[model samples]
Target: MMDASVDFSKEMEALTKDLVGIRSVNGTAGEREVAEFILRWLRSFPYFTTHPERAFAQEIPGDGLGRENVFAYVHGTKEAGTGPRKTLVWHGHIDTVGTEDFGALEPWANDPDALLEKLLAEPDLPDAVREDLATGDWMPGRGACDMKSGDAVFLVLLTYLSEHTDAFSGTIVLSLNCVEENEHTGILHGLDVLDELKEREGLEYLFAINNDYICPLYDGDPHRYLYAGAVGKLLPCVYIHGCETHVGQCFEGFDASVAAAEVVRRINYNTALCDGYRGEYTLPPSVLKLADLKPAYNVQTAQEAWTYFNYFVHAASVADILAVLKGIVKDSMDEIAGRIDAEAEKYAKLAQQPVVPPNFQPEVMSYDELVAAVREKRAAAEAKETALDDELAAMAHKLRAKGRDLREISLAIVRELVRELHPTRPLAILFFAAPYCPANTLRQEVAGEKKLYDQLESLVSSFGEETGEQYKILQFFPSLSDSSYLKIDDTPESVATLYQNLPGGKTVSPVPTERIRSLSIPAVDFGCYGKDAHKWTERMYKPYTFGVLPKLILKAVAEFL
Candidate 1:
């Protein structure tokens, strides 16, 4: 039970409002302020103050973006004399996406109350959404729903556990991490913290709980989900290198954007990729970001263009994802080749002139193959030289250490390599970007894995029986989460093969696959209820989010511990 003095609703509301107002948007001066505030808040508690070692902060060094991760824990009586005590981790990311114009309340950037008032008054706000706001039931801002609410919930629960340690019998870990909006580096920090904690206290991790926002089923539906796994995300960028032509002779050369657009047409919102598991879980590929890779306004038929997609996967591995992306590139390029050939035929007929033969077929090559070719060429050129430069070695060290700049450098190298190796052929290179988050689930193939999931189901069922409320075990979390960082058993050889096959593999973020797999802990995403996650209309339903969700968390902790 919670302390009678603590007003859970009011505290949550105040915390949520303050947190949402803080601009912890990814890539800017991100998460540092909010994380410092959390550390200070943790110290305010008598328990943490006395055991200050229990709370700590870590910096993810190579992030280059200056993001930090925070962690704290409340120890139960049993933890002091632990042989191997169970631990429950409450993890939440403190980062939000950009604060684009918040529609009518754009001016209320610093004032959350003004923003909430405007949200309540806006005529365009849907009735179902507005009605919920009227009943002490709204939080509006960038991070309000897409998870400051979850942070508030975790804080309250952690505080409660601290105040009433006798109610539970194991450690409750609080991880208020950064960079979930982008790289998911905070969870990596959490893994480090867990390792240290395990070494110090000899504790065993039981489950990780990520209280992300869970959107309602529909307008009026109040039911929420308890997700066992998260869908993986891979952003595969397709670079089209075309032959430039003067504007007057535009039909003489193909535009790179034409080929890029065709790729988008074949991929964007395509339902065939949305394969379902158990005929219920599905995540289709969507275009998160795309643009013509040109600078300034001079139009020379765009010699090069690129577009990346928000490709999602449920049961697929890196190899599976690469195969699908390769297939899409091939099919789109084939169609583009036919279109270009048709245009060439039409141009020849109209002008009765010698039309430039279109090299519509695009050459595709993996990053490894390109790198190997570049190495061979460089070796031959260097064979005549006797000495290596010290400056080049220093530059190599810098590049490896600060990998954030590798993508552009790799692209430049690939372009040069292509010019030297296959001067006449146009290239359409498909490759992954930074931050590869692989999908993970509690597989029941092993007896231990089966037991854990079965126990969770039984606990949820027990809670449902007590409250007469229905609960569901969601097969996959619809959104990407930090839980993807938790390691699983995957072959290093297989991961290496896939990595080598990726077109820009050398530039992609080096995901420590084996390290991640070694620390794989099962996780559950039981979060707040909201809608319009990344939009101006984003708001968390207060009644279910602030009220019932906390109780569910408390119940789960009690049962699991």
Candidate 2:
């Protein structure tokens, strides 16, 4: 048996610092180095053996740099009278999002000594210290929350099991992959190699636990949650066509950027056909962009102009829903193009003009099941909300004001629920588009549709659980419309700050006071970094781990293999 005196805090701090010290920034060629470090660490353990030639060095497109994936395994002892039941796989990715300061790897600014000092100096350090200031309740650092901490946690658990081998019930395998932040190519490659190993050994795996974002001890909860579903992503690029002309010219024709803006406006406003969930299908636009390319002097020149627009569609949507969205775009484009043509003809009567045509293409997620999973999650969230209010009121007492405490408590419960719910969403989406015009300004007078902000409000209001509770829809744009437009910077630090700020005057639902007793962990401010893996926009939460990890682990252990 292991010593109870062993300080897990010291070990965790050291491991965190060591991990942060390694520069495994994505798009950099340092993955091999970091992989080797992990290999060495795992090899030092007597219970684990590195898989020969299983460490793969791969070069990705565009970056022209080599990355690596590492694998290892440990045999499980058979029961006194029964053969080994099955093999369990624990997977983690070793790559991190890139930052301008690639050299930040040396001498982690957030070190153990620093953390210990802070922890000990705190006025109220509970006997069972469950939170880290550096990360608050969430995992901190570049890859800390993403999967590196997961790697460390896996190692810690394995090491503990090794010392107390009798505690484990089955065989376990460790798979550390690279390039998850890129295209998950390393994972695909690793799986292929595993297949080859299985063929050679005539063995099969019964269960796989992806420690991608596993938080073992976030909250004090004792439940372990297992994930059996995954959501896919769909990124489609929409292009608009218009006319370009000199700024001084009396251009009466369409501007490509302006036309694209109208398209976005319509997308944000028109909701009669798009609002509410249809069957198991739901559609929400994740990101929208409007871009322009032209000479500074000839911005108004009567030449073909174009701009690209991107959208992140949820995986739960059906083919029919996508077709409907496309049809909407098509109709909008036709109207815009017609107006531009008429304006061009009118301008031609007085001066010279050019022709423009609207164009768009669709890029979909590779898997359909992913879409289904996301839809199911939305349905579950709705159901949970329906049941939450009554549950909260039951726990409230005379000392606390029912409404105020209930709101706070409900908000906390919902926050926890969202964390559990988000992982069920798709990983990412890819979009494809092409240019079709210069000044894509297709402005024809069409009846204005209800804005998206209003539609979202209606959807939230339909919950009808409480009143005076505010709701706001936050829109993320990849690029700025102009200097005044807010741009989403996908860095962890920036995301953390944004989550803390809740800018754009948006109001989030508050937690109900009565439901606070049900929380696995105390509520803290947190941010989300969904499955936008390869967009260089991946983020880590600084406070989620303390409040969410333990509950998730306990749930997984109790309910799932």
Candidate 3:
């Protein structure tokens, strides 16, 4: 199956140690360093030395840090005498989250052995962590588990496939992406690279294998698993507007803060909104951000506020997310209005004044409708030569250039639109925010795909029986990953809803919906097991990660190629 002389374990351990020691945290110059290091390592091989074009670092289009993704292509020795046969892809992100959580271990966090030694001596270590350390099987350090281990596995696999072309039937394209921890700029650009390569080289894409980190769903988890699909993420943002009034006139008007709390109360960790796939359910949506848009705090009631949520989806479309969110916003606003009306009548009766109910009719609309309504109203104002939309766009551009975050830019634009449109009081504007990842799965309906899936399941189970390495097969990975860029399970028409509804929709990284949809690359997540990914105690098991994972991944990929 492979060259008996080559030591896969030694190669993996050496590469992983070097990779983990390089502080390639997302949003730093270390991203470039990791890319350069990978390129050099790839070029060291005889195959790449003769074909240097197969190994190089590609710069992402708009990365301000000049970050790059390493690309290594290995063509199979088996040829069909046609143009180029089929190709399988191996994709992994090389970036890691920041090391701030390491605290006292920050100095040694990049050095796994030193960090493990220090951790073993610390009397204050947690009982569970100490137990894992005592076993002498886990390597603790930053990026050791979250995914540098996976990256090293892919690198070593690339070299192995290069040396033993007969191990796989077709060619292989292994890509180490950057920016997955933040904006996902690398893989987004990589979609273009694959498309161009396909056109120029006539290589048909078969599938992609993403080696993101895998972990026990809980402590003492005994079974390892692989997934056929990965989860998708969407951000449903809400901008709340209220009638501002002085604290003395509190009951006379509705404060946006009052409505914001009700929204969170109705939405926080509500499991009913979740979507399930192939016998598994996605984690329920939760608010990642919520804040009032008040500039300087005073006694005046908060008039404008905003919130955005982290929503994971399996089969839900952009339209489905918008509909569910719109329904929630409508109900939350209605309850708020009814409560304010009741309070206004009670306050009047208590003051011995004329009894009356507050009549601020609640209005709710989607971002698309709001923009259109604003356009309709602003046309009249622009008759006197004022371009409302242009003004907001320019302001957002300036703020973004100043390195302001997307959520802040989103809030500013929504606030400006609501303030100008003046859509009465007690209003809610619902919209989607940046960084929308679409969910995809193996296309069972596609010819021969179901067979491949079945073969993989059977092979993994038999392999476990043969080697005593246990694993359960999952239909989907339960987290977000760069594998999202591999394919589109949804239609192009359905994804346009996301493109239209994002704030400053034209400014964000554009997903070529039609182009990506055309390339239906089945994806899977198979990688090393570990725990506490971003914590100071992050670690991966060396026995399985180094000794067993590479062989298993090679076998699984051979089935596809």
Candidate with best TM-score: 3
Q: How accurate is candidate 2 locally (lDDT)?
A: 0.39
Evaluated at residue 19, the lDDT of candidate 2 is: 70
TM-score of 2: 0.51
lDDT of 3 at 250: 78
In candidate 2 the C-alpha lDDT for residue 236 amounts to 35
- Model 2, 1-561: lDDT tens per residue? 324334344354356457755767765667777787877776666555434433333333233465666766554442432543345556667777664431332243223344444444555545433243333432334555555655665566555555555544444556677766634446544555556545554444543445554223234433222222122222333333344445665244445565555556556534343322112222344434455435465446323222223333212233443455556555555566566556656766666545432222212221122233444776866654344323323433221233332223322332233344353211211112211000100011212112323432344343222323222222211211110000111233422322222111012222121121121110010112222222222223332332233223322222212
Can you write out model 1's per-residue Cα lDDT over 417-530, one digit (the tens) per residue? Answer: 566565355677776665577777676676876787888788778777776657788767878888777744335665675566443443346566666676667778988878
Residue pairs whose backbone atoms clash in candidate 3: none
Q: What is the C-alpha RMSD of each candidate to the true structure, in Å?
A: 3.5, 21.8, 2.3
In model 2, which runs have C-alpha deviations exceeding 4 angstroms? 1-9, 49-63, 80-85, 100-140, 162-170, 214-228, 243-254, 268-283, 293-297, 300-318, 338-561
Model 2 steric clash total: 68
Answer with 1 or 2, whichever has the higher lDDT.
1
Sort by lDDT, best first.
3, 1, 2
Task: Quote the lDDT for 200 in model 2.
Answer: 54
Q: Ten consecutive residues with minimal summed lDDT in candidate 2?
A: 434-443
* TM-score of each model, paired residue for residue: 0.89, 0.51, 0.94
| lDDT on C-alpha atoms for all candidate structures | 0.73, 0.39, 0.81
